[model samples]
Target: MVYEIGDNANSALKVVDRVTETLRGDQWQPTVSVNEAREKVRIFVKQTDGLVDGLVVMVVGEADKHHGDTGNEAVFVNIVGEIDPAELGRITKKLNIDVDV
Candidate 1:
């Protein structure tokens, strides 16, 4: 799933914090990475009974890298494998970003 959570770097970091902490609380270990030059944050976790097991990639930078706009972001979540429907819903809720479709 892909979500737009605004383009504020601070907010993006907060989102990363919330996600990691929430997963930790659920006993799911998460590996995190941050790319300074590209302004990207990445997270990986194993799917657990109550946690998402997937890779989360957050890119924060100019929406129009070619001059469209500035400060834009897109977050992507890649589920590593199959999971229960309910678990998927729970994961989305934790991410806290609304899906338009």
Candidate 2:
């Protein structure tokens, strides 16, 4: 049977969900901050394979109250633990984001 556009989209979503579930296990979920004007989700990702220490990622809303005018920065953060600043900077650069701890 030929799949319609909607079917393809749904299949893609399912695939995405599966990938997310698989990858998310290694990454910690963000904690919500209620007091802040905009809710911020902070997650700490522990390093694996004897790499450097974990890093923190903050997911904030796109609302102006969250200090995000473009609302494109769904994830923001800086490196934490035993890691090099330069390395973190490189990663942030690759991600097209400015890391803030």
Candidate that would win on lDDT:
1
Per-residue accuracy of model 2 over 13-85 as CA lDDT, tens digit each: 3433453455367674332222244333334455656565766544433345345353323444556577764
User: What overall lDDT goes with each candidate model?
Assistant: 0.56, 0.45
Candidate 1 residue lDDT tens string, 1-101: 54455555677667767776776786555454555654555555566566554544444443556765545665667667655545644664576533221
Candidate closest to the true structure, highest TM-score: 1
Q: Provide the clashing-pair count of each candidate structure.
A: 2, 0
What global local distance difference test value does model 1 have?
Answer: 0.56
RMSD of each: 8.5, 10.0
